[model samples]
Target chain A: MIPFEHIMILSAAIFLLGLIGLFVRKDALTLLVCMGLLIMAVGVLWIAVAKSFGEMLGQGVVLAIIATAFVQGCVGVMLILKLQVHKPSLQVKQFTELKG
Target chain B: MRVELFYLIAILCLFFSLGAVFSTKVVTSLFCFLGCVLTVTLLFVLLQASAIAVIYMLLFCLLVSIYWVTAIVFLPKPNKNAYSKHFLHVGVFLLLGGWLLFVLLPFLQVPAFSPAEIDHGFGSARHLVNVLFGPLRHLWYALLALILAFLISVPVLIRDNTKCGDLS
Candidate 1:
């Protein structure tokens, strides 16, 4: 078995990568993708700690989170498509007029 | 041996995740995102969360379908200036963020606490179904209803907006 700390470190690294991607990417689709990665990283972290404690709730939470992520991705894509239909662009800068 | 494989999968997951974030073309980035999800699913399998692994694999199929639809419908033009403009800033953030996570690593470490008689079948689908429909049944049903509502309302919202010329 791998040391528990190693898995924690890997999960942390993935979480950070997702955070960076969220910050750097301006496209809505890319942002949605990063959000999914972030959610996955959190699920991994939950599983790791839950395994250490010998509990099943973490896995259950992970399953729920994945389902929620699926719904979120679908809604996000639909909103993006609606935006594209109106504006014909997917760039974040193009939508800045609504920032106020 | 399994530990080594876990490490290999972790590295691949990180590499593909970075590729997904940094790729210039949208399609390439989407493909890399799929790769990252697949690698993470493999990690779940290695961790013995077979049900979550299978669920993620199914979710990955759904994601790929969404990717294809977005690719055909949106067809975003590549942002040529994104890399050159944001590379330095993101690199600095990553360096500092990584250092912070490394420093916090010791605090996050949990002592090995595996029970003597661990339930090896904890993450099986049967176990999951029992848990969801047992103690967590109400919450699960509520979430399902919410998701269904959202699914039904989104298209209606879009159509209404289009009809009202709000989106035009």
Candidate 2:
């Protein structure tokens, strides 16, 4: 059987993968998707830590997470709308037009 | 043993997290992320934090997914070429994984700190609400204020000046 620590390590691994994707992908939308993965990985880490302690009440953290996700959604919508203003393409390379 | 159950849920969370990260399709990745959150929420339940788990599932998994999908629907599909060109990223992932394993192996070999154990009373939502309203209430109100500011700023930020019906 896999140990809890092993499972946490696996989540970390997955998060690292997402991080790499976030750094390497130049496409803004793909970066957002990778960021979402990173967020999911962190949530798994939170759950693992909570379970390890044997205490309950992840409410505050959950609430905070939902709020952060909402903020991210807002930012994403704004970015897409901004993209509509400057360029039709979602590629970060094309964003060079905004460069000073 | 309870440890075994904890490990099972942890593995489920990890697998779904990995799926969420590595899946190329954005929608599929979101689904996998939802699975990951659900597993984590179950882990929270096992920890006796039913309130947190339920909130996480309801808000993060269900509601946030809807918000993200709706947001993405407005954007064009991402370019395929740049994403597929990231071969070096795989090497970076492996290196990071190895470094993490090296750092964690020693710590994992030891037993967890006893003081870190979950408190018994932590499962009660009544206590949580009471505590939040007592000391943390200000923080909650601050968050609300921040959201209000964000709502007010959206129109000023996204107004279409050109009226060309999207720059595309």
Candidate 3:
């Protein structure tokens, strides 16, 4: 089995990648994809801790997260589609109507 | 072998994740996301959560299908600027966060570091079902209801937005 520290490092690294992408990317789909990466990282952290304690709660939480991700993904797609209808650019900055 | 597999999966997962965030073509990015999720499922399996891995694979199929069909079929090609030139902004956040992590890592108290002995059924489907229907019944069941609530709310939200004629 892999050491727990390795899992921790992987999760943290992935989370950092996602965070950087979220801040630095412009396309709406890529931003949402970055969010997915962040969610995956958190799920990994949860599972790692749960596995350490031999508890099933981690996996259960991950399941709930998967459900949440699906719903959010659908909603994201819907919003993206709607945004496209009004302004056709994938650049998030173009949809500045939401901005104050 | 397991350790090697873990490292390999970790690298592939990260690479695909990067691709998902940086690929200019929206369809390719969606494919990269699918690859990243699949690699994560492999990581889950390697972590001895085969049950979660299986369920994850099924859900991921559903999720990726939505992304692929919508992004590839419905949407036009995204602009080539998949990445932004906001380096100064990104750098400030990264530097501050990194400094905080550096300053705090030494003081983090990770007590009792030894992992417990795991059983064969530790994260098995049977184990999950038992726990979901048993001790964790309330939490997981509530989660199901929460998902259902989201399912119900999204359509209503879109309809409301359409009728109100404003982006509230």
Candidate 4:
């Protein structure tokens, strides 16, 4: 039987992966994916906490996660489009064109 | 029964999120992202947050999916020469993995079921709202306003300026 703590730990690991990607990656889209990872970790935490509380609040937590994910997805797509058009590539270094 | 199913769904979500992150192609990323969103919505359902779950499925999945498709369709594709080398990426991955393992090892050793029990009453949305609006009200409003400002400014700042780029 999988323990609830196991699930939380796994989520935390996934979150760390995303964090590594966010900090180490040079691509704009990859960073966005990392952001998604961070949000996913929070979603998992909220769900787990809701279940443990036995408050039937899982739905509320999920709703919030979905809402947040939608917003992130919209912004991610727009950023990728803008990056591709301006830099002709996805690498973050190319975006340095805006630098002083 | 439900817990096992939730774990399975969570694993699937992780897979799609990986796909979304690792794919070099633009359209593939969008599809993977869609998968990730749907998986999380299911997770929301498992947790019993129905109202939030519906909004997530409709507003997040449907609405954002359309916008993502539109954005990718209009965006220019880069030359294949832009791809990064593989060995450097592998090294970075290994280093990050090592660091993460070190950090998580201590935390993972402790059991989650500690002495304190989670209070069901104060965990609801009502309590959350009260806590946010009562003591944390100004901070919350400030954050919303800042996000709004960012939404308004980012497009103007990051507009396509490269004439040599593809037309898509």
Give TM-scores of the second chain, every candidate. Answer: 0.56, 0.51, 0.56, 0.44
State the DockQ of every prediction.
0.54, 0.26, 0.56, 0.24
Q: Clashing pairs in model 3?
A: none
| lDDT: worst 10-residue window of model 1 chain B | B110-119
* lDDT of prediction 3: 0.74
- Chain A TM-score across all models, in listed order: 0.91, 0.82, 0.94, 0.81
lDDT of 4 at B157: 65
lDDT of 2 by residue, A21-97 (tens): 77766656556656766766676566556556643334556556656865685687567666756666556787766
Candidate 3 lDDT by residue in tens digits, A26-83: 9887888888889899888888888888888788889889889878988998888877
Docking class of 3: medium
Give stretches of model 4 more than 4 Å off.
A55-86, A97-100, B62-67, B70-168
Which should have the higher DockQ, number 1 or number 4? 1
Model 2, position B165, has a per-residue lDDT of 64
Please give the C-alpha DockQ score of model 4: 0.24
Interface RMSD of each: 1.2, 4.1, 1.4, 4.6
B29-105 in candidate 1: lDDT tens per residue?
Answer: 77678778778876776676767877887886577568546755665346434443443444366458546743663
How much lDDT does each candidate structure score? 0.74, 0.59, 0.74, 0.60
Model 2 C-alpha lDDT per residue in residues B47-155, reported as the tens digit of each score: 5555565566666644434534443544455834333333234335545854674466345432221112222345445645765676777888998999999999989
Please give the distance, in angstroms, between residue B166's alpha carbon in candidate 1 and its true position after superposition: 22
TM-score ranking from best candidate downward: 3, 1, 2, 4
